[model samples]
Target: MAKEMQKTSMFIERNPGDCENGDICKNLDDDGRVKRTGTWVTASAHIITAVIGSGVLSLAWAIAQLGWVAGPAVLMAFSFITYFTSTLLADCYRAPDPVHGKRNYTYMDVVRAYLGGRKVQLCGLAQYVNLLGVTIGYTITASISMVAVKRSNCFHKHGHHVKCQTSNNPFMVIFACIQIVLSQIPNFHNLSWLSIIAAIMSFAYSSIGLGLSIAKVAGGEHARTTLTGVTVGVDVSGSEKIWRTFQAIGDIAFAYAYSTVLVEIQDTIKSSPPENKSMKRATTLGVSTTTIFYVLCGLVGYAAFGNEAPGNFLTGFGFYEPFWLIDFANICIAIHLIGAYQVFAQPLFGFI
Candidate 1:
């Protein structure tokens, strides 16, 4: 009889609350308290995905132009900048949530709190432009991945050099649309889990590719091959001038793209619990792990590709003919890029 009554009460509670000139449970918990339900790993994964993007593929090409020395230097400089910006933003968010009893504070709220009035309006306008740019970049990278897959299949409809145009390929658009729709279907919590898995996959891809690239170099294969290229409108005086320009900016651009997420991660960490030494230790460990992974990736890509290396570092850096891993990495990166777009676009979208 008690079990039957308990089951009936559970069913009643599942439905919408009914009030007949009466009050309700404000906490919405049987014990009358709210609970926090996420860990550092989940937060770290979210931040990492926010940091990484389609930029990972292009980093190698950028590094080749600038030489190895500039690569790490740029990464460290950008890391400091990102960390500062993220911490500032996170501090801005903390107060509003407590004052208004709000669950989350959007970017617009911060602008309104600090700038007020017309400044908020101007900020919103800028966000619209930024969001558009991010979405376009995400779509373009996904299409590129799809085209890469198709070309790899000997359906040699065209050479590997063909550019992927969304207009010409309806199927590619459909595939991308499917991914976007699926992405939307997953709630934020589920999407965060997916982000964690993708982060792990990214770290693994970097480690394995770097390891293989190093092994090959140690065995006497210089791996001097060009997997891809891009043409710019700027006219150079000579191939030497072009090479110099590449040497100056190539690695910096790549490093900048990958390190953009450091700021986001810092923002997340600021909000987390630091009850004991473990929190500080975890933060240090997470940052160190990511840094080492980045260095390994850059080292392997540099050794394997040499100067003629492809613009996308992972291509020839890994063992040849591991088609499954290649496809998996490509897809993982494409998905990761979408999350990067999400973080970038979300703030901008709020302004809109």
Candidate 2:
């Protein structure tokens, strides 16, 4: 409360004669003007990096289970929802000038402003839990991608159980080490170049997946038909089917979930130009780019592997013709996940 009053008083005495320590008070302009300095393109890249992570790799499997019709529909719905909620986060950057004309640097701040202290605590809890899950998810995805890249063959006899003895622990430890260093970079704004690289990495792997699918189909080595029915409104049979469909929906939702870090990304976009619109533009571009990739990857992957699609697309769809591409895509995924870990972990670090 005292800190809030001091800030309020500082803004009030922003005038020349009101402050005895005029230099210090003036330096404490501490308004949106100074906070908003990031370039829109860079901000868009960060947001893109945040949205497109390991989730995209599994998107194909979800589509396969849900079939073409429902899969695309779910992806579109999440695209719209994620985009809308993200813009709402950008708008929360500056509360009404009367309250606090400064920028909100994190999602927790926004929740605290609108919902109060308890909600802020809940948001922090949720944020950390979400980050922890993302870290684990990324770790698992990276390990699987690496394992897939190194596999000599999958020609083992069925019903003859062979102990693969795979442990993702080493891979996870390597990334955890990377994050321990990257996370110390101090802030999101500093990651502009890295974010751009991560964004391009996302596009590269996604395009590779799509291109491989198309190539397989052209070579007559892939199936274009769905493993499950795609008829709209066709009622699924039994409780098991319904439950599986619901699980697919949850998967799609999880794929598009990035609201936890929206505010933090927005903080990097400048408000200098009073009516700063960079944040909204960044969110739009990021969501639009990811949605496009999601659609193409899902549709093409399902067509390539049919219902045989594995939960991890990189490992499931093995295009051995020019196998170097597989290695490149998996490497890119690992690189992208590193940046993604920083994106989520940075905000959680601040909250701590």
Question: Residue by residue across 1-352, what tens digits does model 2's lDDT show?
Answer: 9867644553353445545756554434454122335767887888788888767777777887788778898899999999888776677777755124665667877777768868877877888898888877877787777665555133232222443445667877877788788877856768887888888888888888888878877778755445363323443446656676788789889878888887777677655543237777877888898899999888887787776566766665446545567778888888888887788778777767
Residue 324 in model 1: shift from native, Å?
Answer: 3.3
Tell me each candidate's RMSD, in Å, in order. Answer: 8.1, 5.6
The residue-level lDDT of candidate 2 at 115 comes to 82
Model 2: weakest 10-residue lDDT segment is: 152-161
CA error at residue 117 for candidate 1, angstroms: 4.0
lDDT of 1 by residue, 1-352 (tens): 9967643443244224443333443322222222224356665676566555555545555545555676556556655554445445544543454322222235555677767999987876665665567567667766666555544443234534554333426645755676566555323333455667667756655655566567767889764432222223332235755775565454444333322223233223322353112223433444456556665665566666666556564433233335455566666665666555555554443333
On the 0 to 100 scale, the lDDT of residue 266 in model 1 is 29
lDDT of each: 0.51, 0.72
* Every model's TM-score: 0.66, 0.83
